[model samples]
Target: MGEAAENLNYDCNYNMFLAKIMLSNLSRPEDRQKAVKWMKKLATCNRSIEEMKLRNDFMYYLVVNIQQGELQPPFTDNPPTSPLPNIANLLPGGIAEVETNEMGEPSSTQQTKKPMLYENSPDGGAFLAAQPVPRCGAFCYLAVVAREPKHD
Candidate 1:
Protein backbone atom coordinates (compact mmCIF):
# COMPACT_ATOMS: atom_id res chain seq x y z
CA MET A 1 0.00 0.00 0.00
CA GLY A 2 1.07 3.60 -0.69
CA GLU A 3 2.33 5.85 2.16
CA ALA A 4 -0.78 8.12 1.83
CA ALA A 5 -3.13 5.16 2.31
CA GLU A 6 -1.09 3.98 5.32
CA ASN A 7 -1.27 7.46 6.90
CA LEU A 8 -5.04 7.63 6.32
CA ASN A 9 -5.49 4.27 8.08
CA TYR A 10 -3.37 5.47 11.00
CA ASP A 11 -5.50 8.65 11.36
CA CYS A 12 -8.71 6.60 11.32
CA ASN A 13 -7.35 4.30 14.01
CA TYR A 14 -6.32 7.25 16.18
CA ASN A 15 -9.75 8.92 15.91
CA MET A 16 -11.54 5.66 16.77
CA PHE A 17 -9.25 5.20 19.79
CA LEU A 18 -10.12 8.73 20.94
CA ALA A 19 -13.85 8.07 20.54
CA LYS A 20 -13.64 4.81 22.57
CA ILE A 21 -11.84 6.53 25.43
CA MET A 22 -14.33 9.42 25.48
CA LEU A 23 -17.28 7.03 25.48
CA SER A 24 -15.89 4.87 28.28
CA ASN A 25 -15.09 7.75 30.63
CA LEU A 26 -18.63 9.07 30.26
CA SER A 27 -20.04 6.16 32.38
CA ARG A 28 -20.06 8.18 35.66
CA PRO A 29 -23.10 10.41 36.26
CA GLU A 30 -21.13 13.65 36.67
CA ASP A 31 -19.02 12.86 33.63
CA ARG A 32 -22.07 11.94 31.58
CA GLN A 33 -23.76 15.21 32.60
CA LYS A 34 -20.67 17.19 31.60
CA ALA A 35 -20.47 15.35 28.27
CA VAL A 36 -24.14 16.10 27.60
CA LYS A 37 -23.67 19.79 28.48
CA TRP A 38 -20.63 20.08 26.20
CA MET A 39 -22.48 18.30 23.39
CA LYS A 40 -25.41 20.71 23.75
CA LYS A 41 -23.04 23.69 23.81
CA LEU A 42 -21.32 22.43 20.65
CA ALA A 43 -24.66 22.06 18.94
CA THR A 44 -26.02 25.51 19.91
CA CYS A 45 -22.95 27.75 20.32
CA ASN A 46 -21.53 29.98 17.57
CA ARG A 47 -18.80 27.78 16.10
CA SER A 48 -16.57 29.35 13.45
CA ILE A 49 -14.78 26.83 11.26
CA GLU A 50 -12.78 28.67 8.63
CA GLU A 51 -11.40 26.39 5.92
CA MET A 52 -7.96 27.55 4.78
CA LYS A 53 -8.82 26.53 1.21
CA LEU A 54 -11.37 29.33 0.79
CA ARG A 55 -10.40 32.47 -1.17
CA ASN A 56 -9.94 35.79 0.75
CA ASP A 57 -13.06 37.46 -0.74
CA PHE A 58 -15.23 34.43 0.01
CA MET A 59 -13.87 34.32 3.54
CA TYR A 60 -14.79 38.02 3.95
CA TYR A 61 -18.40 37.27 3.02
CA LEU A 62 -18.52 34.26 5.36
CA VAL A 63 -17.19 36.36 8.26
CA VAL A 64 -19.52 39.27 7.50
CA ASN A 65 -22.59 37.01 7.50
CA ILE A 66 -21.50 35.39 10.78
CA GLN A 67 -21.19 38.86 12.39
CA GLN A 68 -24.54 40.13 11.01
CA GLY A 69 -26.34 40.72 14.35
CA GLU A 70 -23.52 39.97 16.82
CA LEU A 71 -21.86 43.37 17.12
CA GLN A 72 -23.10 46.10 19.56
CA PRO A 73 -23.84 49.57 18.15
CA PRO A 74 -22.59 52.82 19.69
CA PHE A 75 -24.37 54.63 22.62
CA THR A 76 -25.44 58.30 23.01
CA ASP A 77 -25.44 60.68 26.03
CA ASN A 78 -28.50 61.05 28.30
CA PRO A 79 -30.04 64.21 29.89
CA PRO A 80 -29.29 65.16 33.51
CA THR A 81 -31.55 64.72 36.56
CA SER A 82 -32.49 66.91 39.58
CA PRO A 83 -30.16 66.87 42.63
CA LEU A 84 -31.13 64.86 45.77
CA PRO A 85 -31.46 66.96 48.97
CA ASN A 86 -29.58 65.78 52.17
CA ILE A 87 -27.74 63.02 50.26
CA ALA A 88 -24.28 64.22 51.30
CA ASN A 89 -23.57 60.98 53.27
CA LEU A 90 -23.52 58.95 50.00
CA LEU A 91 -20.37 60.80 48.87
CA PRO A 92 -16.91 60.41 50.40
CA GLY A 93 -16.27 62.86 53.34
CA GLY A 94 -14.13 66.05 53.11
CA ILE A 95 -14.16 66.14 49.30
CA ALA A 96 -16.41 68.69 47.58
CA GLU A 97 -19.85 67.22 46.69
CA VAL A 98 -19.14 67.08 42.98
CA GLU A 99 -22.12 65.64 41.10
CA THR A 100 -22.05 64.29 37.54
CA ASN A 101 -24.39 65.51 34.79
CA GLU A 102 -25.78 62.00 34.13
CA MET A 103 -29.35 61.07 35.21
CA GLY A 104 -30.11 60.17 38.89
CA GLU A 105 -31.34 56.66 38.06
CA PRO A 106 -29.97 54.19 40.61
CA SER A 107 -26.94 52.84 38.72
CA SER A 108 -26.13 49.34 39.89
CA THR A 109 -22.49 48.30 39.42
CA GLN A 110 -22.44 44.54 39.50
CA GLN A 111 -19.20 42.50 39.45
CA THR A 112 -19.92 38.80 38.97
CA LYS A 113 -17.17 36.13 39.01
CA LYS A 114 -18.38 33.25 36.84
CA PRO A 115 -17.25 29.78 37.95
CA MET A 116 -14.99 27.65 35.71
CA LEU A 117 -16.83 25.28 33.36
CA TYR A 118 -14.31 22.39 33.35
CA GLU A 119 -12.66 22.61 36.75
CA ASN A 120 -13.29 18.91 37.55
CA SER A 121 -13.42 17.43 34.06
CA PRO A 122 -12.01 13.91 34.11
CA ASP A 123 -8.58 13.00 32.63
CA GLY A 124 -10.43 11.58 29.60
CA GLY A 125 -9.77 7.97 30.74
CA ALA A 126 -9.08 6.68 27.26
CA PHE A 127 -6.36 4.42 25.76
CA LEU A 128 -4.13 7.50 25.56
CA ALA A 129 -4.68 7.92 29.34
CA ALA A 130 -1.64 5.68 29.54
CA GLN A 131 1.68 7.61 29.41
CA PRO A 132 1.86 9.68 26.23
CA VAL A 133 3.82 7.71 23.63
CA PRO A 134 7.17 9.19 22.54
CA ARG A 135 6.77 12.19 20.18
CA CYS A 136 8.73 10.54 17.31
CA GLY A 137 5.46 8.67 16.47
CA ALA A 138 3.63 5.33 17.07
CA PHE A 139 4.47 2.50 19.50
CA CYS A 140 5.62 0.36 16.52
CA TYR A 141 8.57 2.75 15.92
CA LEU A 142 9.94 2.14 19.44
CA ALA A 143 9.31 -1.59 19.16
CA VAL A 144 11.27 -1.67 15.89
CA VAL A 145 14.25 0.19 17.46
CA ALA A 146 14.25 -1.88 20.70
CA ARG A 147 14.11 -5.28 18.92
CA GLU A 148 16.81 -4.66 16.29
CA PRO A 149 18.48 -8.02 15.35
CA LYS A 150 22.08 -8.13 16.61
CA HIS A 151 24.72 -9.10 13.99
CA ASP A 152 27.90 -11.07 14.97
Candidate 2:
Protein backbone atom coordinates (compact mmCIF):
# COMPACT_ATOMS: atom_id res chain seq x y z
CA MET A 1 0.00 0.00 0.00
CA GLY A 2 2.84 2.37 0.87
CA GLU A 3 4.63 1.62 -2.37
CA ALA A 4 1.46 2.16 -4.39
CA ALA A 5 0.86 5.50 -2.64
CA GLU A 6 4.42 6.66 -3.38
CA ASN A 7 4.27 5.72 -7.04
CA LEU A 8 3.46 8.91 -8.97
CA ASN A 9 2.34 6.95 -12.05
CA TYR A 10 -0.39 5.08 -10.19
CA ASP A 11 -3.99 6.20 -10.66
CA CYS A 12 -4.71 9.10 -8.30
CA ASN A 13 -7.86 7.43 -7.07
CA TYR A 14 -5.98 4.23 -6.27
CA ASN A 15 -3.37 6.26 -4.44
CA MET A 16 -6.10 8.13 -2.58
CA PHE A 17 -7.60 4.83 -1.45
CA LEU A 18 -4.26 3.73 -0.07
CA ALA A 19 -3.80 7.09 1.61
CA LYS A 20 -7.24 6.85 3.18
CA ILE A 21 -6.24 3.56 4.76
CA MET A 22 -3.04 5.12 6.02
CA LEU A 23 -5.00 8.07 7.45
CA SER A 24 -7.17 5.80 9.60
CA ASN A 25 -4.12 4.46 11.47
CA LEU A 26 -3.31 7.37 13.77
CA SER A 27 -0.17 5.87 15.32
CA ARG A 28 1.93 6.54 12.25
CA PRO A 29 2.67 10.24 11.68
CA GLU A 30 4.70 9.57 8.53
CA ASP A 31 1.79 7.71 6.98
CA ARG A 32 -0.62 10.38 8.11
CA GLN A 33 1.56 13.07 6.50
CA LYS A 34 1.63 11.12 3.27
CA ALA A 35 -2.12 10.72 3.38
CA VAL A 36 -2.58 14.43 3.98
CA LYS A 37 -0.25 15.29 1.09
CA TRP A 38 -2.32 13.13 -1.23
CA MET A 39 -5.55 14.54 0.15
CA LYS A 40 -4.42 18.08 -0.67
CA LYS A 41 -3.32 16.98 -4.13
CA LEU A 42 -6.58 15.19 -4.88
CA ALA A 43 -8.65 18.04 -3.48
CA THR A 44 -6.96 20.61 -5.71
CA CYS A 45 -6.93 18.41 -8.83
CA ASN A 46 -10.49 19.64 -9.71
CA ARG A 47 -11.31 16.47 -11.60
CA SER A 48 -15.02 16.32 -10.73
CA ILE A 49 -17.56 17.58 -8.23
CA GLU A 50 -17.87 14.15 -6.59
CA GLU A 51 -14.08 13.91 -6.26
CA MET A 52 -13.94 17.36 -4.69
CA LYS A 53 -16.60 16.42 -2.14
CA LEU A 54 -14.76 13.21 -1.29
CA ARG A 55 -11.51 15.07 -0.73
CA ASN A 56 -13.22 17.72 1.43
CA ASP A 57 -14.83 14.95 3.49
CA PHE A 58 -11.42 13.37 4.00
CA MET A 59 -9.84 16.68 4.99
CA TYR A 60 -12.76 17.51 7.25
CA TYR A 61 -12.25 14.25 9.12
CA LEU A 62 -8.50 14.74 9.34
CA VAL A 63 -8.87 18.14 10.97
CA VAL A 64 -11.44 16.72 13.35
CA ASN A 65 -9.56 13.55 14.37
CA ILE A 66 -6.10 14.97 14.95
CA GLN A 67 -5.37 16.97 18.08
CA GLN A 68 -5.03 20.65 17.28
CA GLY A 69 -1.49 20.95 18.63
CA GLU A 70 -0.37 17.81 16.82
CA LEU A 71 -1.71 18.76 13.42
CA GLN A 72 0.97 20.14 11.08
CA PRO A 73 0.54 22.12 7.91
CA PRO A 74 0.70 19.59 5.07
CA PHE A 75 2.67 21.91 2.82
CA THR A 76 5.90 23.77 3.46
CA ASP A 77 6.09 27.50 4.25
CA ASN A 78 7.70 28.33 0.92
CA PRO A 79 5.41 29.35 -1.93
CA PRO A 80 4.91 26.93 -4.81
CA THR A 81 7.66 27.12 -7.42
CA SER A 82 5.01 27.81 -10.05
CA PRO A 83 1.98 29.81 -9.01
CA LEU A 84 -1.31 27.97 -8.74
CA PRO A 85 -3.88 29.09 -11.30
CA ASN A 86 -6.27 31.68 -9.91
CA ILE A 87 -9.66 29.95 -9.87
CA ALA A 88 -11.55 33.27 -9.90
CA ASN A 89 -9.96 34.14 -13.24
CA LEU A 90 -11.64 31.12 -14.85
CA LEU A 91 -15.12 32.45 -14.00
CA PRO A 92 -16.97 34.73 -16.44
CA GLY A 93 -17.22 37.91 -14.35
CA GLY A 94 -14.75 36.74 -11.70
CA ILE A 95 -15.37 36.83 -7.93
CA ALA A 96 -17.11 39.98 -6.73
CA GLU A 97 -15.45 40.18 -3.35
CA VAL A 98 -13.46 38.19 -0.81
CA GLU A 99 -12.94 39.00 2.84
CA THR A 100 -9.55 38.23 4.33
CA ASN A 101 -7.91 38.71 7.70
CA GLU A 102 -4.77 40.71 8.42
CA MET A 103 -2.65 37.68 7.62
CA GLY A 104 -4.70 37.11 4.44
CA GLU A 105 -6.52 33.97 5.48
CA PRO A 106 -10.12 34.04 4.20
CA SER A 107 -12.59 35.51 6.67
CA SER A 108 -15.45 33.23 7.67
CA THR A 109 -18.32 35.61 7.02
CA GLN A 110 -21.46 34.17 5.43
CA GLN A 111 -21.29 35.00 1.70
CA THR A 112 -24.93 34.49 0.76
CA LYS A 113 -28.05 36.26 2.00
CA LYS A 114 -30.40 33.28 1.50
CA PRO A 115 -32.04 32.04 4.69
CA MET A 116 -32.63 28.37 5.55
CA LEU A 117 -36.16 27.15 4.93
CA TYR A 118 -36.27 25.77 8.46
CA GLU A 119 -35.67 29.26 9.87
CA ASN A 120 -39.00 30.42 8.45
CA SER A 121 -40.99 27.44 9.74
CA PRO A 122 -43.58 27.75 12.50
CA ASP A 123 -44.03 25.04 15.19
CA GLY A 124 -43.64 21.69 13.41
CA GLY A 125 -40.72 22.02 11.01
CA ALA A 126 -39.71 18.76 9.39
CA PHE A 127 -36.31 20.01 8.30
CA LEU A 128 -35.56 21.34 11.78
CA ALA A 129 -36.58 17.99 13.26
CA ALA A 130 -33.98 16.08 11.30
CA GLN A 131 -31.27 14.23 13.20
CA PRO A 132 -28.00 15.89 14.19
CA VAL A 133 -26.51 18.02 11.44
CA PRO A 134 -24.14 16.38 8.98
CA ARG A 135 -20.59 16.29 10.34
CA CYS A 136 -18.57 17.04 7.19
CA GLY A 137 -19.52 20.72 7.03
CA ALA A 138 -19.83 21.13 10.76
CA PHE A 139 -16.45 19.54 11.44
CA CYS A 140 -14.68 21.89 9.02
CA TYR A 141 -16.47 24.88 10.51
CA LEU A 142 -15.62 23.84 14.05
CA ALA A 143 -11.99 23.26 13.15
CA VAL A 144 -11.72 26.81 11.82
CA VAL A 145 -13.46 28.16 14.91
CA ALA A 146 -11.04 26.28 17.11
CA ARG A 147 -8.08 27.89 15.36
CA GLU A 148 -9.25 31.45 15.71
CA PRO A 149 -7.16 33.53 18.11
CA LYS A 150 -9.09 34.37 21.22
CA HIS A 151 -9.47 38.12 21.32
CA ASP A 152 -10.44 38.43 24.96
TM-score of each predicted structure versus truth: 0.20, 0.27
Q: How accurate is candidate 1 locally (lDDT)?
A: 0.31
Off by over 4 Å in 2: 1-32, 68-152
- Winner by TM-score: 2
Instruction: List lDDT for all candidates, in order.
Output: 0.31, 0.45
**Predicted candidate 1 versus true structure: per-residue lDDT over 15-130, tens digit per residue:** 33443345444334544343333223222322222211111222222223223422111001111122211213322331134433356433346333333422332433332336
Residue 116 deviation, candidate 1, in Å?
32
| Per-residue lDDT over 1-152 for candidate 2, one digit per residue giving the tens place of the 0 to 100 score | 24433332234455455546655555666645654664665546444444444444444434444433233333222213342334343323344255666776667774644345545555334645664755224522121224668898
Off by over 4 Å in 1: 1-21, 50-152
